[model samples]
Target: MKKEVNIILAGSLGIILGIGLFGLRKFLKKKSQDYDDYYADFHRHFVKQAKDDGNDGIEFLAVQ
Candidate 1:
């Protein structure tokens, strides 16, 4: 009886840990995708602004 109880407890613990890991992976992947989308939008705007202003984007890189 005692061995059976231990096995049950271990199994439950393993299941909980697995679920937590899976959730964490999903959350990180979503956050990573959000970051990539933000960067792409920023790049698009930066290039558009540079083109509209008639300046090569490299001038912004000069040390002040």
Candidate 2:
């Protein structure tokens, strides 16, 4: 019946959309974690370098 076909099509569309959204969320979460890790490593390296060179890190703010 026509009504049954419409219901089936709507159901399938909803399921596809849900799956797409879930996949996007997972991908973003992973990318965010990667970015955080990179920032931490960079900060550590910068601090170590500053200390080795006898500096206490940058306290002066840059003028915009």
Candidate 3:
């Protein structure tokens, strides 16, 4: 009886850990995508602003 209870507890713990890992992976993926989208948007805006500045032959430095 004790062995069966231990097995069941172990299985339950494994399932819980698996679910937590799955949720973390999904959250990280969504956050990464959001960061990528924000970067793309900023890049586009920077390029557009540079183009509008009318300095066609000059390169701009990106300040971090």
Candidate 4:
């Protein structure tokens, strides 16, 4: 009976950890992709302005 209870507890813990890890991975991947998009958009929209406007349009950060 004790052994059976231990097995059940271990199995439950494993399943919960697995689910948490899967969710964490998906969230991180999406965040990474979003950052890539944000930087691409910033470069596309701002680089030309910086060049055209000279020092007046220089930017170090972007907000969406």
C-alpha lDDT values of all predictions: 0.86, 0.83, 0.83, 0.82
Instruction: Please give the RMSD to the true structure for each candidate, in Å.
Output: 9.2, 10.4, 9.6, 11.5
Best of the candidates, lDDT: 1
What is the descending lDDT order? 1, 2, 3, 4
Candidate 4's residue-wise lDDT over 1-64, tens digit each? Answer: 9999999999999999999999999999999999998888667754544345444432543421
Distance from true position, residue 24, model 4, in Å?
0.5
Better of 1 and 2 by lDDT: 1
lDDT of 2: 0.83
Give the alpha carbon lDDT tens digit for every residue of 31-59 in model 2.
Answer: 99999988877677446342365544566
TM-score of 2: 0.63
TM-score quality measure for candidate 4: 0.61
Question: What are the models' TM-scores?
Answer: 0.63, 0.63, 0.64, 0.61
**Looking at candidate 4, what is the lDDT of residue 59?**
52
Best by TM-score: 3
Per-residue lDDT over 1-64 for candidate 3, one digit per residue giving the tens place of the 0 to 100 score: 9999999999999999999999999999999999998888657744633245555443454432
Runs off by more than 4 Å, candidate 3: 44-64
